[model samples]
Target: MLRSLVRALSGEVDPEIEARVRAVSQGVNELGFDKWGFSPDAVKHAMGLYAWLYREYFRVEAFGVEHVPPGRALLIGNHSSQLAYDGIMVATALLLEADPPRAVKAMIEKFFQHQPFVNVMMARSGQLTGLPQNALRLLQEDQLVMVFPEGARGGGKTVWERYELKRFGHGFMRLALEARAPIVPFGFIGGEEACPSLVDVKPLARLLGMPYLPITPTILPLPLPAKCSVYFGRPLVFDGRGDEEDAVIEGYVEEVRSSIGALIERGLSERRGIFFG
Candidate 1:
């Protein structure tokens, strides 16, 4: 049924991508849901749906995909594009490009739960609620968890603020320390140009209970075809107890933030043009 639904939504599912997705070890139950609500079927469907955007539309160039180590790992990334397409692209790359493909379990905002169908789709597609416990549990289970330390602030950036990472929260650092997971910092470029926000309507966002209400030239959240690039860095491990002073934790967070920032700069230097690179 899910395959049929996926075929209906996207008539073009790459055979190689399909084989790679099936090779992933999600450990789902008979009903197709893992303990944390991951459905292999749903993930495959999502891959089919987003594969086009990742390929023909955005023409995403993924570098250092092999940097993602096996077993437990924390993927820290810079977030942008109000719609969170950066996360989607990163996940897609890991699933399609990595050797012995991995299905990344991304931590998402709780605010999305209020939306109707979007909520269910997210959970089934292996996205977890952005809570400390959820992230810790996934790490303990040896799953690859993607986290955006900048949270909604990074996602709501205006065009001018693009690639300039917002202040990163220290919670992810604490989780990594606790789980003994290696951190893979990555940077995503071109989302800001894809859906550049001219301004954020504060009053409207407050009323709607959203992070930010962006006003773009499109007037909608649709992303333009901007050449996207994701640069994955080597895994970083910090040695310490998870229970550390606030200042100590902040240092780890800063290190990861700086690494992501450097990646962004590298991508910028290599980019030939926003729409062509």
Candidate 2:
């Protein structure tokens, strides 16, 4: 029954898209047993469903995909919504739209590893804990790594705080410098529509052991669909040892945040309508 509901929400994939997905799924077949526990089959299944949302539901528009250089880059960006639809949309765009599809390994919070089904699915989907060790290793292996510097603060915002970037952790800067990986700052224009949270219920979220428990007013449980636009910026390369002082690293981190903030502003500026991008 739950699967049926998801299928209904996702609708159907066209023949061309189906063919493309099938071809791409073949390359990552062995991803499951790999170090990251990435199950290619599971990824294919999820991608098929996300494709429906990407092409139809949110009508996602991915820009500057070419800016995502191949291999060993840090994908740093803003976060939004309770469930991470913004991140999923960016991942979907890279998988289905980018030239020569690339695999993105995102770092999720460690507490997620405690959840049963979610933990399993997250690992199988190539998500690792947000640890410096894991990030360094991924970059060393020349994989595309993603980190949400905003953490939970951005995801838990109310509608009034929409598109406003929160303070970022500087850990990603150190990791990128140590790994010698370029940092790509990206932005999403309308992810707040995924969960138009109006109330910031901090007390309840504490009871739930969540970062931020948001009271969504727009769609309740099911996320209300809105047009989503993802913009990628040119890669920023930094030269330094990984062990820089916090003050120095903060400067670099701020640069990334500012770039993403500007990108978000541009996307919002050019937006045509709420349901259309």
Candidate 3:
């Protein structure tokens, strides 16, 4: 019955898209649910909606998606637009544009887990809790995992602070080292302009148990139709055991951050305008 509902919600899926999504590894059980709650059917159903946003609304242009090497890989990208559309676009590009469609297991913030029904949606859509253990397990299984090192700091960026990367957390770097997975740094441009924020209301956010409440020109941070670009760089490999010293881990984190910064700069230079692509 539930499966029927999912299919009904999906309506008619493109046969080519259905084939590509089925090609990705999902590891579901008889009931079509993976141990982590991923459902290939659910992912397929979601592709149509996100694909429209990727192709039409945002008009996202992705480059170097081929850099996403097969097997275990860590995708690191900047997070913004309060709503996390950047992550969606990045994941969509990998699924729709990569040579072989790959499912991205995004590491999600704990704050979102508390929202009503959000946990179920996130799991069914192939997202996992942002825990080191979960990410490690995915990497060990040769799955592609996506992480945003900037966390809430980057998500709360105001218009004035757009494109400026906040301090990165070193956990992703250490995780990559431990899993022996290559890190692919990608930069997402235009999120700030899409959902420009003027200020973050910390007091309100605290009252609501939210990370930060952003005040945008539209009052809500709904994304405007902004042309966005995502640039994927070559894979980066670091030498060290995952348990390196804090200083060593910090250095490695800095290198990845710099790579993403450079990618962002490149995307900015290539872009003609916010809404003009």
Highest lDDT: which candidate?
3
Write down the worst ten-residue block by lDDT for model 1: 1-10
Per-residue lDDT tens digits of candidate 2, residues 15-105? 5554554544433434335656876656666776677778777888999999999878999988866676887788888888877787788
Candidate 3 residues 1-277, lDDT tens each?
Answer: 3454355356678687788888884677899888988888887777877777787778899999989999999999898577878888998998899988888999989998877787888888889889999999999999999999999999988988999999999999989999999999999998888888899999999999898898878745458888998999999999998998999999889999999999999999999998994
Estimate the lDDT of model 3.
0.88
**Each model's C-alpha lDDT?**
0.87, 0.81, 0.88
Clashing pairs for model 2 are: 31-38, 32-38
113-151 per-residue lDDT for model 1 (tens digits) = 778998898888888789999999999988899999888
Q: Give the candidate order by descending TM-score.
A: 3, 1, 2
- Model 2 residue runs over 4 Å out of place are 1-32, 218-221
Q: At residue 39, give the lDDT of candidate 3.
A: 82
Candidate 2 TM-score to native = 0.89
lDDT score at residue 23, model 2, on the 0-100 scale: 48
The estimated TM-scores of all candidates read 0.94, 0.89, 0.94
The superposed Cα distance between candidate 1 and the true structure at residue 88, in angstroms, equals 0.4
